[model samples]
Target: MARMPLAERRRQLTEAAIRAMTRDGVSRTTTRSIAAEAGVSLSVFHYCFDSKQALLESVLTMITDHYIAVVKEAIRPRATLRETVRAGFQAYWDHVAARPAEHMLTYDLTQYALREPGFEHLARRQYELYCETYAQLLEQLGRQTGFELLVPVPVLARYLAAMTDGVTLNFLVLGDADAAAGILDMVTDHVAGLIRER
Candidate 1:
């Protein structure tokens, strides 16, 4: 219908794939359906992606990118490290509250990747991305705020990633926003305690 760059087309297809997977499921969603969701021909989907693994990778990355962008924006230097950290965590929680389907799709995609033959690496890649995102965010915050962390960045990053993953999953399972917020506050305080003014 309209001329678009390959990168843009791939992004479009990736978003469409997310919707298709969230609605139908990773195992049930077909490339043909993704093409239909994106209003593109199957050939266009093929042109953008070589295989299901590639599409799955794109979908996972897109989902992570979505919240990372929000958290990065929310994490900009604040009056205090606790405030900044809380803002970032709150931003992510808001996204989960608003788009539970998308968040749930991420968990589903991970399980699908892990269980499917020849796609276990996608699940690993998903967790790696999570850890990497936390590490990058920690580095960026440190640079911006000039705070020293008692915990090493790598260790802290993994811990934060695992903690947030569990919290999100807990909220998803319980559907309790209040409990999620309280847990987030506790974790935020714990994390803020890990940092000291340089």
Candidate 2:
């Protein structure tokens, strides 16, 4: 392969690290494994990241970015708030279904971050990013639908994030896609109810 820019190289390494972690588990993954997965030399890995923790942090950020883009693309302005909310949730479910390994890796990374002393902040920031992304989406939906939210957007966003985390964990553990989706639909309904008709 041709030489890549520093930013592109970093992205490549981050993706490779995620693939390694997904396949080998966080405890088994190492800088050498990530470098081999990326088809780069060990020196390249060191040049791109300060350490394994830094690379994992990049992986977390990448997952967050991917999820936000998926949800944003899934949600569009619709005639009714209910339809808009359902579409967004369905789109997210589809994304998770298509990339179960990547999604599972995210959860694993979260646990790893929490257990590792220096990385606890990454776990906290990951949830914060989730909340902020949802809050922005909810605020925009409210404005577009011309429906006042029963609760503050930020509060609703935090609730949605926490609820989804639980639902996702259960689904991952039980391998029950249908049940997980049903719960998401219920969440959509609840969110729709929060918006009064104009």
Candidate 3:
């Protein structure tokens, strides 16, 4: 294959960094390791990312984008509200299970963001954006289908999103997908009940 251009190389390096962090946690994904993984020199890594934090922030964004896509793809208009919600949860669970180590990377980046003023703000805004977007989608679906949403769509969406995050964290902490899946089932049932109520 032809050599990748600088722009492509930068993107490749960033993606490789994300993969490394997901596999080994952020602390273990040093600049050297990322450079090695990307088949580039340490100097190239620095040239692309001024600091490790910058690289990590970029990788975090990539991971977040991947996760958001997973959630979006799971929302099928043909499905009932409850099934849509359950499918969303299952998609999230599968995302975690597909690359369990990525959960650690996500948690680590979350913790890392907590310490930085800029990243903290971005994290908060991103989460709020997700809540708003999903809430609106759920509300529209409810209105379109005449489904009795258990809670207002806005609140329900936020709650489900939070539950999804909580489940991911639990799996990361316990290293037990089974336990996480069981808890997810309970959360799913509660969400379904909310929408199913008359």
Candidate 4:
């Protein structure tokens, strides 16, 4: 393989680990498997990441980033804040529908992290990352639309994070697109109500 920067290689390996874990599960996926999935050798994998914990952290971050990027792109200000938020949720739903396995893998990763010794922090960090992502999105929306949230940024962010996690889990378990859309609509209205227009 051609030479690459350490950061790039680590990202490549992390993505590979995601795919491998999604396919074979976190418990089953080994460093050898991740290396093979990334088309790198075992030594290369170790060079990039010292342990599987690091890889798991990278994978969780990567997963969170995938949907957050979509939501950010879709969250541009529309005619109304409600419409803009709806667009963002729609974008997220579209992503989940298209990549169900990847989303499912996130929950699996969470369970695995929680059960694994000394890895509980990873699961905690995962939720923290979710809330942080939501906070940034809320901040971005505020900037774009010049609206104030009745709730503090941190509180609203955690609320959004919890609601989203529940909705995603509900959709994954039930596979009811219509119900999911309704839940999204209810959430959109609730979230919009929290905003104070400038």
Candidate 5:
């Protein structure tokens, strides 16, 4: 057997944790289960993460990073701000549709983190990352389109994050793609309406 590089090993453990949480729910998932899922020993799991809470934090970061990449790739400069914003929203909902399991796991972990003592910071940091990432994206879009948002970039970013969370959660619970698409279109239109051409 060969030793995995440090980064690779960490990624493996994180992925395993995601699977365990998705399969067993966050409350039931354990470090031992995650290690088993990763095909690593308990000692290796301990070496990688001090506690399950630490591992959940890493999972939150990984999930957020993935979402940021997806949105960034989906959105691009377009002829009009409306087109750009609509395209971005469409791309995002498409991603949620494709990976419902991952999204569900994220929501589950969020609840888990919020209820657990000393772990609430992970939930706070997760939303902060979302807000920060969206703020940067909104700034870039404004630069590209010469449009100004009705609200400050940070406020709009937080609003968009909250909107996305609501839409995704609704879709997850309802399992209605058509309804989700309609809601997404409505939300995108409202968001696009917020930007004035400068």
Candidate 6:
């Protein structure tokens, strides 16, 4: 039998790890199990990742990075602050809705991150990157629309980021799409009103 290509194998392992974490939760995911699911050997899993924590961190980073890029791309040039906020939320809703399993993986890792040193740093980095990305977009929109932010850009960015994370958890836990949508609309309107008032 031919050996699998290295890049292909790595991708398979990452995806399999995400699925495994989603099904069994990060605490239950092991290198052996991930390798078995990927149809690879334990050595192959080790070759790709130093440990299960690393594998889970990679999965979380993959999900967060992909969504960050999507949200960044969705913000139109010359966008009003309100329009940019709407676009960011829309991107988030679509991404979360489409990849519910990835979101579950994120939640599991988040729970583990509270105690796991390996994942704690990765989680913090991911959160900081996301905040900075959103803050940059917000600042740009503020400049374009001549609407000063009521809160500091960093504070506003963190607030919006936390709100989205909370909404994702609420939607996943309660399966309440209507409530989630309504709350997001309300939050966006309030933020818009604040921006206009400033």
lDDT of each: 0.94, 0.86, 0.73, 0.93, 0.86, 0.78
TM per candidate = 0.97, 0.93, 0.73, 0.97, 0.94, 0.81
lDDT of prediction 5: 0.86
Lowest lDDT sum, 10 consecutive residues, model 4, at 159-168
Per-residue accuracy of model 4 over 1-198 as CA lDDT, tens digit each: 899999999999998988999899999999999999999999999998988999999999888898999999999989888999999999999999999989999999899999999999999999999999999999999999999899999998998889888989999999999999999999999999999988
Which of the predicted structures, 5 or 6, would earn the higher lDDT when compared with the native?
5
* Candidate 4: Cα lDDT at 20: 91
Candidate 5 per-residue lDDT over residues 51-103, each given as its tens digit: 88778889988887887787777678887767798888887887899889999
Worst 10-residue lDDT window for candidate 3 reads: 136-145
Candidate 1, which ten residues in sequence have the lowest lDDT sum?
Answer: 72-81
Task: State the displacement of the C-alpha of residue 4, model 1, in Å, after optimal TM-score superposition.
Answer: 2.0
lDDT of 2 by residue, 1-198 (tens): 688898999999999988899999987899999999999999999999987777887998898788778888877888777789988888777878888898899888888889988888878888998899899888777777777888888899999999888887888789899999889889988998888866
Please tell me which model should have the higher TM-score, number 2 or number 6: 2
Which regions of candidate 6 are displaced past 4 Å? Answer: 1-9, 77-81, 117-119, 139-150, 194-198
Compared with the true structure, the alpha-carbon lDDT of candidate 6 equals 0.78
Model 6 lDDT, residue 76, Cα: 67
Name the runs in model 3 displaced over 4 angstroms: 1-7, 115-154, 193-198
Candidate 6 residues 112-155, lDDT tens each?
A: 88777656776786678668777877876666566787778888
Comparing 2 with 4 on TM-score, the higher-scoring candidate is 4
State each candidate's clash count.
0, 0, 1, 0, 0, 0
Q: For residue 144, give model 2's deviation from the true position in Å.
A: 2.8
- Residue-level error in angstroms, candidate 6, position 49: 1.7
Clashing pairs in 6: none
Leading candidate by lDDT: 1
